[model samples]
Structures are given as structure tokens and as C-alpha cells.
Target chain A: MIVDSLPRTTLTEIAGMAGGGAALPALAARLNIVEMTQAAEDAVLQPKDAGRWPHALRAALAARIARQNDCPALADRYAGMAGADMAVADPAVAGEAEGLTLVCRFMDKVSVSPRDVAARDILELQEAGVSDADIVRLCELNAFVSYQVRVIAGLRLMAESVA
Target chain B: MNDVIHKFTRNVPDWRPRVTPVKLEDATPEQLDALQVTPSNTKVSAYVLTLAHDVETLKVRSPLFNGIMYDPGGLDRAARELSALAASVLSRCVYCAAVHAARHAQLSKSTEVTDDLFANGDKADLTPRDRAIFDLAYGLAGSPPAATPDQMRAARDAGLSDAEIVDAILSSALFGWANRLMHVLGDPVRKGAA
Candidate 1:
């Protein structure tokens, strides 16, 4: 929730100022990162993935982790995706709940104490039927989210300094 | 202080990765595109290739990353490398720590400086400007993240411009993520090993 307390006008101005000049290149790079983040989220929640994991369930897990990490913005974003009416009845969630939860647990661990992630953690995912491909994707998402948190934190710090 | 830095001093890898990488031939189209081909057709490092498992993210990651770490403006190469090393060392990612440590040495042209930093960052022999940068980098790498306001003051007092400070933030922050990725993805092994 790094963006939560900021004025919408100021943010718009920041976005606007990024349109041209020396800032343009950096802005474009940041915008691309934003798009990439969106794309990854979309891929994770896309219908094709519904068979393996429901978007809502995944979002719920993300929301829970975001809340734990004190990222109000991310928490809110994920909670919205999780939706008001949520349950584990979806076969994807019911069947692979353990695997999914483990991924969530891994995200939580990596968010703070990344060094603690042991070989056993990866092994457990494999034992639970999470394919190597899935494990890789999970790591990617976890890694990206961890990056996102710091990036946002840094940006917020920058913004606060200017403000 | 010595306990904080990575213990590896020599026998670093020549061109080998610590972990099993996704071979280029096995890469997806997106992953293939993630490779940064130079005039001679060289590509990104083995570490990046291993990240091909998620090319959608890598595409954006590459550009933002290049801009922050390798772009020609803002903090000088040595200072940025110092920021990178500070973060990598504290994060305890031996792979990235070594890369940046070597780069810092090469750019600064002082092996002893790099050695001092790796041995004990806080006590590293540094100029006033370098000390300021290190303070911020170490602060950012702290568990709860050192106080931003104070670090900013220290940087400004040490004579860094806003843009330079931004570079410091970006350099250190990128490694915050990078180190975690290396730690989770695979191990960093010594060269000539089975």
C-alpha cells in the first residue's frame, strides 16, 4: 500500500512529468516494469490456469501474505481480486490446496528471510505434485513480488523526500 | 564485521554458474528474446538465462534493470558497484557479492579497497563521498531498512546530488531482489568443480 496515502493529483503529476525529457527514458522503463507485473498477474489468473489454480484463491493467498508483510496497497489489490464471496470449493483449490499454500508460505518466507529457504522447502513442493515448471513460476512470482515491495518502498521514500 | 561478508576470496568461477541453468537451446521464444546479444552476438549472463522460466517478467525486468545498473548516467561506475556490493554482501548472496566486488575493484582500481569492503564494510577505508554512499547502502540493506530520512541527510551532507542519491537507492534496491533470486534459484559454486 505504498501509494495509499499519496494524493492522487501528485501521483498524476509525477506520471505526467514522466512523459518527456531526461525523465522519459527512466519513466518508460518503469512503465514497462508495471506492464510486465500486470502481465504476470494476468497470466497467473487467466482462465487456462483455472484448472490448476483459481484466480481468486491465488489472490486470496497473495492478499494474506501482503497483509502479513504490511503492504496495504498490495494487500488491498489482492483482496479485491480474492472477492467478497470466496471459498475453497473450487476443485483446483480443494485438490491442490496444500501445494498452493506451500507456495504462499514460500512467498512469505522469501519476503523477509530469504536465506531461510532450504532445499527441503523446494523438495516439499515437488513431493506435493508441484511440477518443476510450476516451482519455477512460483519462484519467479515470489521473487518479483519481493522485488516489487522494495521498489515500491524505495519510490515511496523518494516521494516522501520530495514532498 | 568480518563475519558479515562472504568468505570467498579466490577460486571464483571463470564462467560457470553455481546452479544448473536452463540451457539456451531449451529456452522458450520469450526467453530467447531475453538474451542480450551484443555485436559479437554474446548474450546475458548464465544467471539471467536461468530466470527464463518466467520470460514475461524478465522482459520488463531486463530494461528497468539495465537502466538502473548499467546506464551511463548518475553515480559513477565504482560508486554504483559499491552500492551493489553492499547490498549483495549484506543479503549474503555470494554470487552477486563476488560479481559486484570484482567490478568494484576493477572500476575503482584498488583491490585493497574491495578487500576492505568485503572484510568489513563499515570499516572499509573510504573517502568522505564513498563513506556517505556506503552509509546509505548499508542502511537500506538493514533488516528493517535503516531510517530513510537520516540516510538521505547523510548522503546530502556527504555532497551527493539528488540524482546520485537516486542511483544509490536503485543500485542497492535492485540487489535486494537480485540476491534473493540467486539465493532461491540455485547455488553459486566454485569453478572447475564437478
Candidate 2:
């Protein structure tokens, strides 16, 4: 349904995905648009289930750490725990989780300039004592010279660790 | 480390597709600069200038033309959705990943979905249709050559229409060029800025 409504660019993109129309357009065009639209509209109107798998993913991650301890079974069992809703009680955990969610959510949007280096590299460089100012300077100079941001960031990290 | 290599992969070339880095900075004064390459008899600076023009076109056309095209008008959302589309492209873009990731979250109106996006681009909490959109974008952005017939079958099974599918390809291609420029020229002005 949503597919029916999207413009040609998006459609072409989707078509391109199926391996460029000469191959897949016949099948894609044959899809039942009317039925699909109804299903999507209904889905959007329904209420959401908040306490879902996000925390479960984290728990599973946490469980891996906990497994080294004596209570492996208990740790593993707890790892499967579902993520609680933000509206539910525990303010502190909720607050931190919310913040983390925002960071992650923010990541979903913009296409970062691949020219810049990884942030992890910058963070590491900072740890090694290369000032933030120098890192910023490098980024600017590299921009002018058309240097890769990833390399620049990596160098900063290396410089910091060495410094 | 090979920062330049890190920024551009075989799928995407540097700003001047034909020009090498050494050629860009070291060519004689009479020789054309990297930014100067363009089709003859045109004032445009080839790749970079073309992008600047198209981005403006996308902005205006998205509102006027694409507005009427989609029933509810998804172009703004589409632009906003470009963030999500971008996240999938920026794996090589250390500078771009977080920015697009953040925009993806804002469009979805949920932190949870956004986080899921970074953890997994196509597998994020998008609707089936949108997922189809993401998958299409991913295939185009990642490996245009290998994006074979079977890949389109997957999208069809996922429920993208012929038209929507076409749009998805255009969006991905637009990003293909857009991502390269941003990667090369430096947009978002900051690593984390969405």
C-alpha cells in the first residue's frame, strides 16, 4: 500500500533493488497493491507494543559477560528478559535507556560525510592527549586538501596514543 | 592508515571518478584541477557542481512534484527518510554514520527504532514496505553490479510495487552520488551532527 503511494524515484529505487526492471519488474508490478495497502493502513492504526526486544538484545549481551560467573543458567535466563517500557517504574534505568535510544535513533537518520574519520578514533586520540583543537584543525585542513576523514581520524587516534 | 581507501570503496569512487588523488593535487597549472573536470562547453564543475544543482532540484521538486505523486506526500518524510537510507551507506563513512543514524531516529519518532537502525540498517523496525525500500537502497548502494534479479524478487516478496521500486532505485542512486560528495566534500559539517 505505502509502495503504491510513493513517487517514482522511490519506486525506481525499489525496482532497482529487485535487480533492475528488465529482470524483476514483471513480478513486482503484478503484486496486489489494493490488498497490501489495506493491510498497511490497518497496521499503522494499531497500538504499538512497547516492552519489546530492545532490552532482550542488551540482556543477551549482558548475559555473555555474566556466563563466566558461577550462575551461568541464571545469567542466561535473565539475559532473555524482555525490555521494560519507558512508562514503567524505574526512572534511572529508563532515563539512561531513553538517552541511549535517542543516540541510536539519531544515528538512523543523517548520512554522515564518509570523508570524516570515525569518532572512536577521535575519542582514542583524545585519551592519548592530542587536544580536540588539533583534531578539529586536522579535519579542516584535510577537508581543504580532500583527505579522507577516516584516515584523519585514525591518525588522530594513533597520534593521541603515542603522545 | 589508508584513510582515502577507507572513505571510498570500489562501489563508490572519489569525487572525480576518473581523477586520482595524486593527479588532483599535483597536476600543472595548465592542467585542469579535480573540481574543474566537466563535459565540454558547460560551465558546471562536473560532479560537484552537478550535485549542488540536483540537491536544489530534489528540494524543490520533492515538494512540488513528488508532493502530488504520493497520496499522503512522503517526500519530506522521504528527505527525512534519507537519513535512514544514508545510515546504510555510511558504514565506510566514519564521519557520516552517526549523523544519518540520528536522522533515521527523528523520522521514525522513536529512539528504539533508531537504535535498531544503527545495529542493523535494513533490519531496523521499518514497516515491511519501508524495509523493502531499505533493502533496495542497500543493494543499490552496496553492490549495484551484484543486485541481480533474485534481489528484486526478495523486494517483491517483501511487497514493494513496480513504481515504488523504481523510486527506491533513484533514491539509492541519488544517495550514491550524494554520499560520495558528502564523503569527499564534508557535509553535516560535523561528525555527529545529524
Index of the highest-DockQ prediction:
1
TM-score of each: 0.74, 0.34
Model 2 chain B poorest ten-residue lDDT run: B13-22
Against the true structure, what is every candidate's RMSD? 6.5, 21.5
**Lowest summed-lDDT stretch of 10 residues in model 2 chain A?**
A144-153
Q: What is the lDDT of residue A57 in candidate 1?
A: 63
User: Considering just chain B, what TM-score does every model have?
Assistant: 0.84, 0.50
> What digit string (tens of lDDT, one per residue) describes model 2 on residues B83-128?
3354335435533444454555566665665456556645567766
Screening candidate 1 with a backbone cut-off below 3 angstroms (N, C-alpha, C), the clashing residue pairs are A1-A73, B18-B189
Model 1 Cα RMSD, Å? Answer: 6.5
DockQ of 2: 0.03
Candidate 1, TM-score vs. the true structure?
0.74
What C-alpha lDDT values do all the predictions have? 0.60, 0.35
For candidate 1, lDDT tens digit of each residue in A34-72? 454445445544434343445676666555544544556
Best by TM-score: 1
Candidate 2 local lDDT, residue B6: 39
